[model samples]
Target: MKGLKKKRKWIILGAAAAAVVLISIIGASMNGAEVESAVVDKGQVIKLIKESGTVEAENTVVIAAKNSGEIRKVLVEEGDRVTAGSKLMESEVTSAQMDIKSLQSDLAGLQAQYNQAKNLADKNKTLYEQGALSYEDYNASNTAAKQLSAQISSLSYTIKSYEESSGAAGVTAPINGTVTEVFIKAGETVTAGASLFEISDLSNIYVKVDLIAEDADLVQVGDPVKVYNEDAGFTDENCKVRKIHVKAQEKMSDLGINQKRVTIEIALSQSTALRLGSNLDIEISVDQRENAVRVSDKAVFELENKDYVYVVSDGKAVLREVELGLEGEDFIEVLSGLEEGDVIILSPEDEIQEGTKVKV
Candidate 1:
């Protein structure tokens, strides 16, 4: 009986030793798995989309001559400030003067002939009434007098037209603005309707932006915009959309592919140091979300037309499909599937798979 009891105690000790070894092996395996799931955290990530465009004047004018003539004088130079009725240029006055003189001479000759015919017709009418001259002679004299009067009247009108045109021999600014361009030089001959200057009213300016049709819906007549000229500086000027073109402009080379682009005219709300015709890079905020959960753009992934992010949960990566909204520069608004305290991979490795162990 003593021998049997000692044997039973030895068997109990062996069983206890086996159980301790099993527990050690399981703990070692769990530790190895935990190490494999480690992940490295990168810096903050932001989501943004970028586009480019240019600036333009809201009111621009090309001053041209009304009649062909030699440029006698230029009253203004490029970059000169001018106002309405300010003379910008002048055409040769010699030709205008000669034209006026010739018309006057023609009028004088017609008037002398008309007077002589009137006297001749009056004398013939008196003679005919007293049977001293023939009816045919009186009629011929009357007709001659009337024809000469008509000729005099026509010449007078020609003279008046020349006078009016001569008054406008000098080109004048139509609006209060600055002369931005001077296309004519003194002694240069310009044709009728040739552009001689470009005047712009810079008090109110417009930034013209050509935007793709897909993005045009976000723009409206009153939406706010930001404009900047890198050549000028980093500070951006605030502006408001004044107009949105509905027609899609075609690309110059490819007629087949009609690029749906609309011109957005943005009015500057504040004065800017930028000059007229200066090319500007523009950014228009289509939407905004305040105090919303957001993440870096790279963190979000697209698959099968759905958006998602890999969130680190319990030392493992879990694919969290998210609804996105109000995307801006370097950041995207997380509409769903994320909380403020959630840890998401900045830039997930391509090899990262769903349910993979990760340490962040």
Candidate 2:
């Protein structure tokens, strides 16, 4: 009985081994899906902020009319070079001058009335004190004097405003620059604060970028930059951050996402005659880390504030948690949970999961 039982146990063990081999063959045949992958490597990872901007003059002045008047003389045209205090245009101020004179005359009349009323008020007060006038009469005289004084003051203010304003005067150049725009022609009627001309010193031109707020905090003045215009086929190898605006502005991107952006100026070493608003691409190396355990960024994904990468091993994909450091354009620095020689799936597909069979 012992011999028979032992022989039966061996037979059962042999049958189980055959079943295991058959299952292995079936699984291997079923998992023939192809996937792309990359190897974890140790190298320098450069964090870069890429932005596109336009070439803009360093200092631009928009000259607007100070008052509403008919343009009498346009002294400068587009492309005309001008200096500080130079006249750019002249507006007819005869009507404004006339209005000032009329206001002054009205003020003079009010002043005379105020004097008469004040003198009458003084006489009434004296009479009331000596029991020569009634209380109602004295009060009325005082009120009249006050009203006249207010009227005179108001008219005086009107005259002063006219005198202080640059009504019908010549608009002068505010700085040494070339006139880049002309909006008014002689005999054109312009309103107060109408834009007349734009002056700019092209020699002070530089690349202006609106950096996304996420990257703006990492950027600083004097940061190195590589600027190029792919369309114009021009590149400035030596460029650095010149200025950063104090405030952030909200702009809508082509994808219809609202983004907070800050303006940064780049001082260019290249000379190009491209006009203002010329587009250019810039690559700013914001930071760098050497000898970091890094992998292709395509291999990483985020879930619930934690990062995950699909790691490949023995024709299977396993999800691994990783702590990330500096993330660059192509690679991400792995601070923990991964090491060199690890194979990771790139551009992980939606169906990939833990223990999923993969053919890399």
Error of 2 at 352 (Å): 3.7
True-vs-predicted CA distance for residue 215, candidate 2, Å: 3.3
Q: State the weakest 10-residue window (summed lDDT) of model 2.
A: 161-170
Model 2 agreement with the true structure over 1-360: per-residue lDDT tens digits: 999999999999999999999998787658745799899999999888898988899789998877787888889899999999898877665777777777778888888888999999999999999999999999999999999998887877777666557553357788998899999899999888899999999878898899888789999888889998777788887899989998999999979999999999999887778778778999988898898899999999998999999888788888999999999989999999898999999999787888888898
Q: Please list the residue runs of candidate 1 whose C-alpha ends up more than 4 Å from where it truly belongs after superposition.
A: 1-53, 93-97, 101-168, 251-258
lDDT of 2 at 228: 88
Q: Model 2, stretches more than 4 Å misplaced?
A: 1-31, 85-87, 90-169, 250-260, 303-305, 350-357
> Model 1, range 1-360, lDDT digits (tens) per residue?
999999999999999999999998677445423322222222333332235556566678997677787888888998888988888866776677777877788889889999999999999999999999999999999999999998888888877776666544357788888888899899999887789999988777667777777778777677667776676674455666788887978544234655767777777776764666567777676666667677777688888999988878876778989998766676777777787778777677765778766555
Error of 1 at 139 (Å): 30
Per-model RMSD to reference: 13.2, 15.9
